[model samples]
Every structure is written in structure tokens, then in C-alpha cells.
Target: MLIKKIKRRIYNLFHPIQGELWCLHRVLNEKSVFDENKDLEISPDYLETKIKHYKANNFDFISIDDVYSKRLSEFRYCWQKKFINITFDDGFEDIYNNAYPILKKYNIPFTIYLSTDFVDRKPLIWWLVLERIVLTKENVVLSSGVIYTCPDIISKRSVFKQLCDLIYNEPDNPADTFRRLFSNYVSYFEEKTANTLTWEQILEMCDSGFCTIGSHTVTHPVLTRQQENEVRREIEESKRIIEKKLQQEVLHFSYPYSFWNEQVQDIVLESGYKTAAMGYGGSCRYNKDNVYKLPRVYLVEEST
Candidate 1:
């Protein structure tokens, strides 16, 4: 905890502009509820209060599209300006019903990155799989050589972060380790709670003139895990689906989970995307930057 505080302080000192604050799962009316058996209960009302605070303070809330467009240029034109871009990951229906109106009212431009598979109701996401075990099982053991029990579930966020860190920092076959862990533990959520965006819903949002849709790959795989051929297929296929559905060229891609390596970066450029967003926390700079591997800030409820 002390290390994290120090890191944040250091980041604030060097990158003081607050260039972009990317947000995920911003639901407006729903309230957070704890469930012994479920991984998460979202609170839309709680999110709204944060949004209100940001607005009241006059923070510049930017969308992913804005980052690729105006904000990118702004960083070049004036590097010292305080700017913050808001981006939503995974196409959630609540983003349309709950977050959109608020953004519209505030006139905040944003980007929504979609995992094409979930749009079609594909099975569980890998991270959610870990979440299932953490949330539902009494005592779970991971193939990654980690053990977590239900009592530990009270610290769900911290547990998840630790699991992710283990996978990321593993010296040998991290990809395989993560895949084994996910495959061994994930189960589907209750049908009613399944959240995904439908084709018609996506079209409506595109037509609403409020959002810019970007590719999050078809299956939401960790790019660093897949073979080069597989990674290329994921990026290319997702662009094709998004363009065909929305009739707009899908130029931007957000790395699934914002995790990637050199090979992944090569695949993104080779697959023909203009810009690819990573989940890394940083501000954008002009001229001396790589367009394909752009960094983004992750916004939490507390940060707002």
C-alpha cells in the first residue's frame, strides 16, 4: 500500500496534466450490492456521483475517439493543458442506458471498445472465470500455484489484481498458466445478470452521434498468449465485424485487458489498425510516440 501511494505520487509529479482518465463499467442507476456467491454487484448511482464530482471540478473528460483525434493534436499543440479522456471497455448495455445520457448532458466525448464475441453472447471472459472461483467457491486452488479461499473473497479486487500480477510476471509460459487457470474455474453467471450489447443497440449508439466504437478483438484473448497467426486473425476479424455492422472503418483497437508485448504490437500494426490503446497508465505526447501502442489511464470509483 505504501509502495502504491509512492508510485501515484511520483506519477502525479511527472505527468501532472492528467491527460486522460479512462473509465470502465460506468452504470448510473444501479447500486452496489454484496453477494456471497457472485463476483460483483454494480452500483450505477455511485458512479453518477463520481461523474458529478469530475464535472463540478471542470476536469476535461475525453473519449478514446477524442484521444485519437483532437486530444492527440492538443497534446502536440499545447502539452501543458489539463485533459482527461473517458473510455469504456467491453460493450455493456448499461453504458447505453445509464452512462450515455449523463455523458450527453455533460457533452463529454468518449470511446467504447467492444469485444465482438460478447456482443454475440459467447461464453465467459477469462477474467470473469477467475472472478467466479473467487466469488463462488469456498476454497479455490489455482494451477498458477496460488490458493484463495472464500474468506479471501472479501478482498475480491485485491485478489484479482494479485492473480493478474502473477500471470503477468510469470517467467515461464504465463499464457499457458492463465489459460489453464481460467479453463479450470469459470462458470456462467445467472442468465438474467449476463450483460452484453446487441447489434441493434450498438447501431443505435453509433447513430446517436455520441460514441466512437473501437475493436477489442473478437474473443477478448490476451494477445501475448496467442500465436502470431491467431493474434492477426483476432484483430483483422474484429475490424471486419465492426465495420460491416456499423458501416464505419474501425481504426482503433484496445488490447484485451490492455495486455500486450512486442509481438502483439507487431500483430496490431500488421493487421492495419491506426492506433491501439493499452491499459497502461500514462499521458500522451506528440511526435515522440508510437501510435499503435498508446497508453491509457484506468479510472476507478475512488479516482473520480
Candidate 2:
């Protein structure tokens, strides 16, 4: 642990940034057997520890709005106080059930990027579907007519990644495409989406005043994989739906699956978002970073 801390400090010394936008998905009481889902879930206890550690280190917990406002101000590259903005993607119910109380206790301001369709009862959450498939069966047949065996953890992990890539590149509706492909093994996809938040719950979070809701595309498709028109519709429609429902303008966005390109960024900006966040990157350097394609640190249990 000491060495890890030292190594982080050395890395930061060379790669300095103004602040970190911490990206997370669900805050669960316990992790699941789905290995991919484990990367997306962190315990409530772990969330609290992270909050405490950042506070102890004197990091300011700011909102997504604040992150945007900083861009307009005079940004000094040297001797700056570090800030942290916590963000949750996909609007999971566990965030309300497990994470909100802890965040409220610390009085931390956070953002939630909603896919909108999650609440509207659309989207298969393909990775979880893949997890269910691999864990349930000893051997699986791929779309390529290739038979993959995963009787053990090692093979399961490998096959999971392989399937995930295939789904990620699915140009058409990924949920529909994959659901049709794995129909026999994935009847529980609809039931599994119960884990996501409802519209009322989302509004309740907004009522807390600490939560800033952002658009994460309507169906949460990988924008880069879709046609330009489809990408535009996804970006614009989600923001439109969110703003209409919340009676407040949505100012930020998070790319679904962290997959985006220059064209997608243009659509996000034209759709009226002040900033757009990507899933993986170290931190934000105020002066140098592009607001449209801002990078974020994906925080899991083992993340520092």
C-alpha cells in the first residue's frame, strides 16, 4: 500500500491536473458473481472510505456545474488546489439505496448521467446479459458459429471479453441484436433492469439539491458505432427528454461505454451540453483539456 501511494505520487508529479471527475456505475451492498459487473460495482463501505480519504487529503467535492464554470475562469496551471467531482452513470437503483445516504452524510455534491431508456424500460445492459450466459453454461456458441468453453474462471474471463467486444461493435441496436443472438440464455434481461432507477427515484435525487442530472444518450448506444444521424438523435433526444422531465436544462453528458469520436463530440456540443465526459482518463487539466471530450477516472473498489 505504501509503495502504491508512492508510485501514485510520482505519477502525479509528472502528470498534474486540476481535478478528477470520478466515474462510477452502481454502489452495491455486495458484489455479484458476474466478473464484468464486479468492475462496475463497489460496496457502500468502499464509497464512504473514498469520500473520507479525499476529504482528509483536502480535495474539494464539487458539482459538474462547477467543473464547467471553472473553464471560463482564469486557470492557473501551478499551485492549484485539487478538486473531485463524483459522477454515477446509468442511473442504478443501488445508488439511491446504498450510495445516496453515504453521500448525504458527507454533504458531497455529485452528478448522475442517465441513459433515459433505462427508466423508460429499454436497453438490455448487454454486459450483464453476457455475464448471465457465461456463468450459467459450461460451453457457449458464438455468433461466428464458434464454440467457446468456459468451465473455469480463466476461460470465463477471456470469453466474456470476447463477447463484450463483439457486442460493442454491433452497429445496429446492440440490445436487440444481442438479445436475438442469445435469446435462449437471456430471458432474465428484462428482470435484471429492475436494478436501474425509476423516474420518480431520479426526481427524488434531484430534489436533494446535491444531485446534478446529465444526459447519457437515450438508449446508451456506442455513438461511434452508429451512423451520424443516429448519433445525433441519441444525443439530442436524451437531453430533450431529460430537460422536459426535470424542468431544468441538462448541462453535461457521459459517453455510453466510453466510446466516442470527434463527430460524436460535435453532436453533444450542438445538443446544448456544457461538457461531455469520457469513461477513462486520468484527470482534467483546466487550461489544456477540451470541455466536449473531458476525461474521467473510473472508480471501482480497488481504485485509488
Candidates' C-alpha lDDT: 0.67, 0.82
Backbone-clash count (model 1): 9
Runs of candidate 1 exceeding 4 Å displacement = 1-18, 26-63, 74-82, 141-193
- lDDT of candidate 2 over 212-299, digit per residue (tens): 9998988887788888999989999988899999999999999988887898888888888899998888788746678887889988
lDDT of 1 at 298: 55
Cα lDDT for residue 7, model 1?
A: 100
Highest-scoring model, lDDT: 2
Clashing pairs in 1: 20-85, 27-44, 28-44, 30-44, 31-43, 32-43, 62-85, 62-86, 63-110
What tens-digit string does per-residue lDDT give for candidate 1 at 1-304? Answer: 9999999777655444436546464454443323311222235565566668767776676666666576565433333455666677778777877777777777776788888987858445445455555666666677555676556545765666677677667653444566666554434333234467888888887777777888898877777867778888898999999999999988888887677788888877887778888777576655434778777765544312
| lDDT over C-alpha atoms for residue 84 of model 2 | 86
On TM-score, the leading prediction is 2
